[model samples]
Target: MQEFFAMGGYALYVWSSFGISLLGIVYLYFEARKYHKKQQRLVRYWLHRQSKKKSS
Candidate 1:
């Protein structure tokens, strides 16, 4: 197991790369979720305005 992790002394580079990639994936997920929620809110607001206009 130690040898496997060592990666022939390139362990630091290899491990850090994996950590950075994981963080990027997590960041993208949250960003996408936030964007989706914002879009939904905008859509709902527009629909509400249209309904109000129609009623008036």
Candidate 2:
């Protein structure tokens, strides 16, 4: 068990590399969702304006 975490004396490097990669992936996921929501709101607003123009 201890040996598994030790990673043959390279534990710090291995663990930190994994942590950075995980953090990057999670950050990108949330950022993408935020951007998507922003785009959706913009599109909805544009459509609403178009409909109002057509009605008038």
Candidate 3:
């Protein structure tokens, strides 16, 4: 267990890298969701405007 944790004395580097990668993945996930919702809203707005213009 200790050996695994130590990672042959490279534990700090290994752990830091893993932590950074995890943070990046989490950030990307949230950003993607936010952008997706924004895009949907824009599309809906545009469609509504087009319909209104056609009616007028």
Candidate 4:
């Protein structure tokens, strides 16, 4: 197991690369969630306005 993690003495580079890739995926997930929520809010607001206009 230790030898597998060592990666022939390139552990630092290998682990850092893996960490950065994981961070990037997490960041993208949060960003996509934020964008989705914003779009949902916009759609709800538009629908509300249309309903109000129809009632008026």
Residue by residue across 1-56, what tens digits does model 3's lDDT show?
99999999999999999999999999999999999999999999999999999999
lDDT of 4 by residue, 1-56 (tens): 99999999999999999999999999999999999999999999999999999999
Give a tens-digit lDDT track for model 2, residues 1-56. Answer: 99999999999999999999999999999999999999999999999999999999
Worst 10 residues of 3 by lDDT: 1-10
Residue 52, candidate 3: Cα error in Å is: 0.7
Q: TM-score each candidate.
A: 0.92, 0.92, 0.91, 0.93
* Shift in Å, residue 19, candidate 1: 0.3
The per-model lDDT (C-alpha) reads: 1.00, 1.00, 0.99, 0.99
Q: Which window of ten consecutive residues has the lowest lDDT sum in model 1?
A: 1-10
Compared with the true structure, the alpha-carbon lDDT of candidate 3 equals 0.99
What's each prediction's clash count? Answer: 0, 0, 0, 0
* Model 3, C-alpha of 26: deviation from truth (Å): 0.4
Error in Å for residue 4 of model 4:
0.5
Candidate number that wins on TM-score, 1 or 3: 1
40 in model 1: Cα distance from truth in Å?
A: 0.5
Residue 45 error for model 1, in Å?
0.2
lDDT of candidate 1 over 1-56, digit per residue (tens): 99999999999999999999999999999999999999999999999999999999
